[model samples]
Structures are given as structure tokens and as C-alpha cells.
Target: MFLGMAVFLVGCAKGGSSLNTVPVKGRVTLDGAPLPGATVTFSPKTPEGRTAAGMTNENGEFVLTTIRAGDGAVPGEYGVAITKPVATAGPVDDPRARGGALTPEQMAQIREQAKTKGGAEGGSAIPKKYTSPTTSGLTATVKRGEKNEFTFDLKSQ
Candidate 1:
């Protein structure tokens, strides 16, 4: 599970400046089981907020970031979308299949895919409706002062 977040922090987010982001973390579950490797996106309901995203670990836990790694998101209402693409054979496959330490070969493959597969397109294990914020039927409100933790329980049918 830690591996998934580590990869995302290294591959997706780069650090430099800061924003008025709060601490937002959450878990994603599909049909009562952890939905790992899924990308959890918080699409801003207003122009005042920016989009924030995080990748779920094997336990489906995630910490959101907007401007930098783990920086969280601006306080506002957001429509949520969760998507996990079908895996192609590689070291960077599904989190369930990827366990234990990473070999140098695995690291190499990860770096390459981090560059090439940034978009991460394919069919999803979950229903297609969960892939889009408009149709996800999920929404969250990130408050300003406290820890913003959420759990999304999605159904297959």
C-alpha cells in the first residue's frame, strides 16, 4: 500500500511552492473491498479551488495534493471521481499483484511508465460512471480547520 503512494509522490507530484491547502485523506472501497491503485480526484465546485488528486494504496488510503506532494486541497465543495485502469503487464501493474521490495528492473520500468503512461487510459475494474465527476454521484466538502477524511463506498451494480 505504501508503495502505491510512494510511486505517485515521486512520479506525479513535484515540490516547490505552497497553496492554502488543508489536510485531506481518505479511503476508497468498491463493493466493500479496498479499491487500490485508483486515482481519487477532487474537482472543484467553484473557481476559487483547484483540482486535487491522490492515488490509492493497496489499502485504498490516499492523501490529496493540489500544489505539491501531500499538500492537500483548498477548502470547498468538490465532486469526486475514482478510476483505476486495467493493468498492462509490467512492474507497474496492479497493486494487488505488486508486493514486497522493488527490484532495479522494476524501478526502471516504473520510471519509464511514469513518463509515458501519465494519462493512464483503459477500461476500469469499477463501473464507468465512477470515472467522471459529473456521473460519479459522489461529493465532498473539505473544511478549513480540521482534518478532512472521507470514505467512498461504491457499488458495482
Candidate 2:
């Protein structure tokens, strides 16, 4: 009888929570290739909207789970942004150095710019557009209890 009661209590506890989650998954790419480490954000477009974001993994894939509370990115539209990473530094003797192409003046300018703030000032990189593109021009719908998939083909605006 004690075993039966224990089983009943466990089952009851499990049944109390609601399964209101809808899985959001997708792949990010640029120029027809996977873009790993791209930061993907899904922002709601309504008053009830809440922001949810995830970064692409090594395989350029991302998944947003347990998206409960605050409407699931609305069942209609959203704004998506993909921020790609930039590379820096290289070997002094590297062949790609342009055969000591950057003259002292140019090198000094580069260093001076790198020390500035907000983008070039702080050695920080900026997207070609100087800002992330808005996916308002794109649409991603969310369905209840089902996974909504999308493939974001990012391009420079």
C-alpha cells in the first residue's frame, strides 16, 4: 500500500505542470556557409513581446527551448539579428603581410585609430552596415507544441 501511495504521489506531481513550450531552432549562414558563433536574437514585435536570444554553436546551429511565459515570439512575426565575429592580429612574418606594404605613416594611422573609442577607436570592429540588419523584413512563425525551424541567410545591408 505504501508503494502504491508513493507511485500515485509521484505521478500527480508530474501532471501538475503544463507543457506550454514550443521549440525554436535554426541554422545561421553567410555566403552559403555555416556561420558559427553568430549571435542570433529573436525579439517580439508586440506589447506582450519578450526578447529571447541564442548564439550559434560550432555547427552554426541554435535551439531555444522552454520558451514559456511571455507570448512565444508571437505566432506571427519577429525581428532577427545575426552578428558575425571579426578576426584580428597575424604573424609578423606571415606571407599575407603584403610584403611590408603598410608604410610607417599608414601603420601609425592604424594604431592611432585602434586606440580611439566606438569602433575603430577601441580596436573594435563594426559591421559593414555599422549596425545589425533588422529581420522585420523576415518572418518566423511559432506554432504551439511544435518546433518552428528557420534558416537565416544573412547578408550585408
Q: Pick the candidate with the highest TM-score.
A: 1
TM-score per model over all chains: 0.70, 0.52
lDDT of 1 at 86: 77
Clashes of each: 0, 3
Q: Candidate 2, which segments miss by more than 4 Å at Cα?
A: 1-19, 65-76, 87-136
Q: In model 2, how large is the Cα lDDT of residue 127? A: 43
lDDT for each residue of candidate 2 in 75-150, tens digit (9 for 90 to 100):
4456565544354544123111222233334434333332233223223223433123242244466766666888
Model 2 backbone overlap count = 3
lDDT of 1 by residue, 31-150 (tens): 999998887888888976777777789898988766556778888999887777677656454332432333445434332333232324655678778876777889999999987999
- Name the regions of candidate 1 deviating beyond 4 angstroms: 1-18, 91-121
